[model samples]
Target: MKKIEIFSHNPVLLKECVEGLEIKPEGTYVDATVGGAGHSIEIARKLESGKLFAFDRDPDAVLVSKKRLSSYPAFVINSNFCEMKKRLESRGIREVDGILIDLGVSSYQLDNPKRGFSYRHDGALDMRMSKQGVTAAEIVNKFSEEELIEILKKYGQERFARSIAANIVKRRSQKLIQTTLDLANIIKFSIPAKFRRNKNPCKKSFQAIRIAVNGELESLEIGLEASFDLLKAGGRLLVITFHSLEDRLVKQKYKIWSRGCVCPPKSPICVCGNVPLAKLVNKKAIRPSDLEIATNPRSKSAKLRILEKL
Candidate 1:
């Protein structure tokens, strides 16, 4: 197994995340997204007789994680967390004391041009987290303009989705969009020069394409369900989301799970007798400290939320 640079991953919210888990020495835990085993390693060390099931869709990550977590009672699986329930069941693990899902792309992936995950360096336009589905090049070169627009708008929330999609279609027709820089250039020129001041012009489009290729949002929805269901009574769920879309999804879902009465507002009586399945550990989402963000800028956008099963 190939090992990654241990220094690559700074483990966003490391202190808050571990403390939020309220780890018991013998309690089982799950690290649903083992980007570089940063969070997984800590979770595993807290366990004595307890087990830690760490998963990642990226084979490279799985390889690196297994090596990093070898010293602890951790099982690194080469699968998406969406399959958490079935995988855990296969391993005879029905419930866990806590689960942590960090929905951020690994720094190693962004830094390695060979993986085709970064626009900063030239590489192929492939962005499959699992390396098992449609590649970004295929989407950019073959997808309809309308399809591209929809993905950019919904996933990336790109303000210039239409212009970007139109540009991709036009550029691809002249010659196939093969590399990250090729698509990045198209995105840069598509947006108005005035609007492209602070942030990288390609950031949103690149993120949208990657999300589409990996089915990331869909996977997160399913993974959240599986993770919540796999928790034992009073077991906590700690989710660290890196963007507004992801953070919103977790916030909305957590709100639903923490709400008590299901009765309609107009209908005063409480007839359904529906009770909350969980309680929010923190009313507001937790953000990284200025100190942490100053050190690891990638963590600036991170938001951590915790919910305990009721």
Candidate 2:
């Protein structure tokens, strides 16, 4: 029973996520988003004859996870979790005992100025998790005001979406909003000063832009289905989301999967034949404890949900 202790970042909902998996020492597992390898190392350490496959979109995370899980039987893949099924099939793996997805940007990305994920940091407005594709800057500058409003409202749940979108368009028309702070300042001014109290007013806008740049929601939608299809009977799927939007998507998807029949109110003959594919392990989403939030403020918004294949 050796330990893996080569990580600097504290993974959100660590205890809850690991416990939710209900690891079988000899069962195969996958860490769908092995950011910083904090969760990977723990899962790998628990494995005996079982194998661990860790995946991350960011090459940096892939490298870190590989190093951390080196002592254990783990393979780190430099790809998004949405490709889990294809990548696993390529490795001749058809079914897995458990799959864990820890969503949202890692602390490394948020702390690094080069990644442009943090509202606190002043850097290029590039928020691509894979460091590829359209940047947050491009979304802010090139996207129409309506497009900006939609993303801010949908992804960020921002109340000042219209004002912020208008301001972004106005600012970009005058000057190409180049940096993260450049956009942050625009967002801050757009929102009323009274609404901007102790908390940062730019957080929502930053999240919306980052999500748009990364295509996170779409990936999650696909990844969940792929993961469930790859799960063996009684196998578990655990997801830790950092925002309400991601959590809502996960919740609704899980609810759909857990449903047994689609018949109307009066007619009950099991005509649809929709047997439940999975059952919710926890009736409600698991949230981090108060102590956990005290220790890691970044985890305050995290919600963990577990579902087992039926």
Model 1, 37-154: lDDT tens digits are 8888888888888889999998888888888898999999999899999999999999999999999688888887777889899998888878787899998888999999999999
Q: Kindly list the per-residue Cα lDDT of model 2 for residues 1-310, writing each as its tens digit.
A: 3332343578988878888999999999999999888888888889899999999998878777777788999999999899999999999999999999999988888888888888899999899989888998889889999999999998889999999999988888899999888988999999999999988999888988888999999999999999999999999999998888899999999999999999996885768888988999999889889999999998898888999998
Taking all chains together, each candidate's TM-score versus the true structure is 0.96, 0.95
Query: For each candidate, C-alpha RMSD in Å?
Result: 1.5, 3.4
Model 2: pairs clashing at backbone N, Cα or C within 3 Å = none
In candidate 1, how many Å is residue 124 off?
0.7
Candidate 2 off by > 4 Å = 1-7
Candidate 1: pairs in clash: none
lDDT for each of the candidates?
A: 0.90, 0.90
Segments in model 1 whose C-alpha atoms lie over 4 Å from true places: 1-7, 264-268
lDDT of 1: 0.90
Candidate 1 residue 226 Cα shift, in angstroms, is: 0.7
Model 1 lDDT-worst window of ten = 1-10
